[model samples]
Target: MAIKGSGSPMEAVDEYFDMLIKSRFIEMFGDIKTNSKGWKCHKLGELGSFKTGGTPSSKHEEYYQGTIPFISTPALGPNYIDDSAAKYHISKEAIENCATTLIPAGSLIIGTRINVGQSSINKIPMCTNQDIVSMMDIDKKYDLLFLKHCLNQYIPYLDSQKKGATIKGITVELLKSVMIPEPPIDEQKQYVDFVEQVDKSKAVCK
Candidate 1:
């Protein structure tokens, strides 16, 4: 796969990592992707493993309050999770008995059901419930925030899948199948900077 620069703003809004030829896009859709750049594309599963978290048994009331933060689907935000944001905490004993898993800080976590598209990069080690999935041990070459955005970018497709009483939200198999853009770290940094600048500008306008 070829490493690509983030290219112009033209490359930013591509459909879930589909790097169409800039010229072809212009010829077909007209001049919009004039600066679109090619980027390496990969399935989310190929980049890292998705670990679904487990919830501690409620029967064990002792696990309800402790020092270790316990993350739930509600804790997930669209992009960032703070170290102080977890609403529940668990005890070491509950972790042992209940077999909850703790992913490291910097891992990108996303909710799989209920509020489906919620996502964020956890700032500390924490355990999430079964309703969420974490990209544990993400490949070092990709930026965490960048990956979150890429995943978030794929959310609409996830939502478009038919829902029913049996399957109301994103499933692991579906989530794993989405293709994502893999730009060079340098290009990713540029994308990050571009986003920050846009945010700051919005704040100034406010």
Candidate 2:
């Protein structure tokens, strides 16, 4: 259907819904100041890849005792994540068998099930359980720190998309299909730099 100017009643209805979707996005992620049309919008999957992890064989006693960090929903913190926070460690044998993907240091993770909307960046390399989704190999064109804050702003939208009457949860497909606004890299860097300075002043490390 032609979007510029709807001619028939049905065409008008389609146009109306299109505008409604964009308008909601504007409301959720404030209108871009410099951009005339608005920020560039991209599906989460287009920007990067998504991976959901799996548990190794629980029956194998050796899989439970190893060096590789096994991340879980309980270990997730708002801003930071320590792999050590994970209760279980997977062995090399488990990694060869059950590992679907490896989440690199500084990559973002969010729980898909019970702890919906909570997110954190891992400080060390690790693998997560099936209940969570992790974004790895994020496109360098976008600032990671900036993307983190944008996701922070986007938590509410994610919550609203949750399905299931008894248990609220999101699927990997749901997360991958979500659309996000992308400000220019330069604009993103400004926000990242500002936050770093703020954290420094607060002595965030201590």
Candidate 3:
């Protein structure tokens, strides 16, 4: 028979299967539930330097075709990140004119104002428009993948706390005030490695 929080009898059995995860992965998961008391909190700026990119004037034909990856809002997708699909390309001359900072691979790229917390790691060196925030890990204390996961986890909560009528954005102050669970560096790496493997496996299944 169907049980509470279960869809059907069979589904209830399926749900119970996940209990094995709790038991088997006990070392990886724990309840340190608290009301944001002892966690070390910092603003986004404090975590890394920020850079914004500019769009080359579209009317200029020279900006239309070249080899550089010019990223914009839409390229940041729900799942798989395909960097090759950016709309604009520029020659060396155009690059000098736009002067946008080229982000390196592994840097955490976040959509700051419009999308708030949506983020992805740049798999290649690329440039982005003003709507995004490029974060360079300063002290190497935080893993970019771990930060990305943390951002994804808290985005809904952050969006709910956002205060604005027209723009609906998270302010720099608010972004900075966001709290993160700062476990030891080893623990952070462990969590990131575990999630990365799971993500890779899921992608293969798709």
lDDT of 1 by residue, 1-206 (tens): 33266654443433213333222223332321122345557778888877888889898888978888888787775356765777888888877876578888888888888768668888778888888888876787787777776665556667777376885876788888776666678866766665555545544544
Give the C-alpha miss distance for residue 196 in model 2, angstroms.
Answer: 2.3
Q: Give lDDT tens digits, candidate 3, residues 1-206.
A: 34478876555654454333223223443322232335554545677877777777777788757777887766763323445657776665656777577787777777756777788888878877776777776447787766676666567766777677886766555665665556677877887666556556544544
Best by lDDT: 2
Task: Give candidate 2 misplaced runs (Cα > 4 Å).
Answer: 1-37, 165-167, 201-206
TM-score versus the correct structure, for each prediction? 0.75, 0.73, 0.72
Each candidate's clash count: 0, 0, 2
> All models: lDDT?
0.69, 0.71, 0.64
Where model 1 places Cα greater than 4 Å from the true spot, the runs are 1-38, 162-167, 198-206
TM-score between model 3 and native: 0.72
TM-score winner among the candidates?
A: 1
Q: Where is model 3 more than 4 Å wrong at Cα? A: 1-37, 77-82, 161-168
RMSD of each: 9.3, 13.0, 5.8
